[model samples]
Target: MSALRFAEDWNEADLSAVHAVLVRSYWCEGIPRETLARAMRGSLNFLLHDAESGELAAYARVVSDRATFAYLCDVFVIESRRGEGLGRRLMERVVAHPDLQGLRRFSLVTRDAHGLYAKFGFTPLAAPDRGMEIVRPGLYLQSTSERAGT
Candidate 1:
């Protein structure tokens, strides 16, 4: 195996590799290919690729204005490649990227991977605070139908 590689930006060529990693590692149930394609175009994504094979191993993204705060999302590593520190390496870049330094807070929502995220200084929202989503009923239903078709 080769040392891990990191890329701060991704292009069209990298999307399929990244989608495969996300699907295999995350079991990302309902996300559309178009959505992933759009996210890859965001300016603040951090991507880690396998150095020797150029396969995407893990990815973390931040949505920021280059000030104030940032949200970290979609952090994952391929199952066959876990326990090798690629997730940590990907997060180190996400947390320490020049544009993200000195943020007031960085946050994420995870259903189960709390232990993995905690190592990078992420913690649950304190009492009196909670995460909430304003679901768009139409979009939610549409995505559900699309996912069922897949």
Candidate 2:
């Protein structure tokens, strides 16, 4: 395997690959491409590449205030790329990002991958009861169907 190259720079193709992964993931299933585009514009995006093939292998982004809080989201390593420690490498770069340091809190919601996050010092929330959210599962699909009047 070629060495992995990690960076914040991204282009349209990169975003498309990231979107492909996101659309299949439970966390972001049915996320609209335009919506993902807007989110990418407003967040700090990290991408990992195959270096040799120039394929986007992994991705993650942080939506943050750069001073007090950050939400890590859309983290993925393509199915063919797992078991290679790329996920750990990706998280290492994310948590160590200069702008993400000393934050009052950094958070993410993951249905699985607890072991992976744990390796990066991410633990179960100490105050889960204090956290609340308005979840709209399948909202994107719903919106699409509505748009088509189906």
Candidate 3:
């Protein structure tokens, strides 16, 4: 296995590779590239890649005000590269990012992988009753043309 490198710079992103993984992911299945691109632009992104090959191996994003609130999402390690601790490495970077410090709340939604986040002090909301969201299931079920607003 080749060594992996971590990068927080969006300038080093291989967006096509990231898109391929995300569109196939259970959470973002069929997500439009345009939408993903916009979301990436609006958030702070973390990336991991093969130091030698330069292929994107993992990714995660955080939407934050850098002061009091943040939402972590779209985290994943490529299926072929699982068991290499890449996800944990990415999370370590996310957790230690200077821009994410001192937040009153840092939250994430994960259908699975609770164990991973647990290692980073992420826990269930202390008050689920106080949390609310207008979730639109299947919001990403759109064709390229529609998703791109063409």
**lDDT per residue as tens, model 3, 96-141:** 9999999999999999999999999999989999988887455688
User: How many residue-pair clashes does candidate 1 contain?
Assistant: 0
TM-score leader: 2
Between prediction 1 and prediction 2, the one with superior lDDT is: 2
If the candidates were sorted by their lDDT against the true structure, best first, what order would they fall in?
A: 2, 3, 1
Error of 2 at 68 (Å): 0.4
lDDT of 3 at 23: 84
Q: lDDT of each model, Cα atoms only?
A: 0.73, 0.90, 0.88
Q: Select the stronger candidate by TM-score from 1 and 2.
A: 2
> Which pairs, if any, clash in model 2?
none
Measured by lDDT, the strongest candidate is 2
lDDT of 1 by residue, 1-150 (tens): 577778876887677766766644433544566777776677488878888888877877777777888877767777778888887788778777899888887778788888878998888788535656664423422555563666
Error of 3 at 90 (Å): 0.7
TM-score of each: 0.79, 0.94, 0.91
- Give the range of the ten consecutive residues with the poorest summed lDDT in model 2: 140-149
